[model samples]
Target: MLSIAITGANSGIGLRAAQALATAGHHVLALCRDPDRGRAALADINAHATHPAGLIEADLSIPDSIKAAADQITHTVGHLDVLINNAAVFDQTVREPRFTADGHELFWATNHLGPFLLTAHLSPLLAAADRPRVINVASKGLLSMPRIRIRFDQLDDPSWYTPTRAYYHAKLAQVMTTLSLAEKAEGHLETTCVRVPAVRLDPDRVAAMPRLLRTLYAPKNRMAVPAERLGETYARLATRAGSLPGPYVDENLRPVRAPASAYDRAARERLWSLSQTATGDPAWAW
Candidate 1:
């Protein structure tokens, strides 16, 4: 069975994916920011899993935490067949920008740079496996903001920061990174970016929302895709044999084109260079 690591596996899509993968008899590693939540998630996953799931406390927004988590994974699993960069912060309530300890915007750091560094740190472990694969997540919400572009110079600037803007911007970077990795690691490893559609939240979470939002979101929530469906999609991509349809795919595992910006080789290269610098230039196995 493949050894798979999924960030943000404590809840929502991540937790569901962990449950599905573990039930499939794969060794699933649930990487979460909170230890308590991780333990609870592990227990739940193990209850139905033939193979007990593992937990590694990891706060992706924090560079030190990501490093420590990678080290822990090395000791626990030795090698990883798949790494799913799924942890992301997208709080819609926050109207102001927040900064990480590293002086980067919270969304930019957590959603983009965090995954970049984590992948770099785990490159060796991934390369050691027989068929290494990396799955990056993007949002189908990007289709709504077709004009959105990566503000390279103002990525961390608070001037024009908005929750939705920051989120999609970072997601766009992730999509570009996936394509770049696929090209750079052509014969060495496999990489793909999944364009996630609007996923329905747990009923409890929706009930916890403010009354106005709860009312407004009810209709949309009904139309949102089920978390379990997307979770299985993630499991499939992690274990499916043969090459992927393309670097970018939809929830159905069908190939889909990325944003036009993702195709600009020069911009992607620039983002790569910036990401390396932001991440302290970890040794890339490719």
Candidate 2:
């Protein structure tokens, strides 16, 4: 069985994916930020799993926390065959831009730099595995914003900040980085960016929303795909043998063309360089 690690596994897509992977008999490591929630998720995952699941508490927004969690994973599971960078912060209700302790914008730090650094830290363990895979996540919502580009000059600037803009900008960075890593890996490992569509929210979360907000979201919620279905796609990406269809794919594992910006080699290289500087330049295995 493959050894897999999934970030933000305490709920939603990450939680369901962890359960599905563990049930499939793979050794699953569910990385969560909150210890209490991590343990709770562990119980639920273990209840349905053939192979017991493990938890490593990690706050991806903090570099130190990510490093500590990586160290823990190194001790707990000697090597990891798959690393799923699934954790993200996308609260549409957030009005003003928030900054981390390190002064970077919250969404850019948590959604992009966190995964980039985590992958770098775990590269050695990944390289040790027979077929190492790094799975990055994107959004199908990006299709609507066909001309969006990574605002390198104003990534952390608050003047142009909005919740939706911040989220998709970071996702676009993820997609570009996926292509960059795949090229630089030089056959040492494989990288793919999953273009996730709108996932249905849990009933409890929906019910808790304010009445007007709930009413506004009701139509979209009804059209959203079930979380379990996307979770299964994550499982397949982690475990499926042989070549993937492409670097960017839909939930069905079919190739989906990435944005024109993702193909700009110069831009991708610049992003890679910027990410390395942001994350303190962790040594990559490939």
- lDDT tens digits, residue span 156-247, model 1: 89999999899999999999999999888877889999999999987877987889888999999999999999999999999998886679
Worst 10 residues of 2 by lDDT: 201-210
Mark the regions of model 1 whose C-alpha exceeds 4 Å error after superposition: none
- Over 148-253, each residue of candidate 2 has an lDDT whose tens digit, in order, gives 9999899899999999999999999999999999899998888899999999987877887788888999999999999999999999999988877789999999
RMSD for all candidates, in order, please. 1.0, 1.0
CA lDDT of each prediction against the hidden true structure: 0.92, 0.93
lDDT of 1: 0.92
TM-score of each: 0.98, 0.98
Task: List the pairs of residues colliding in candidate 1.
Answer: none
Clashes of each: 0, 0
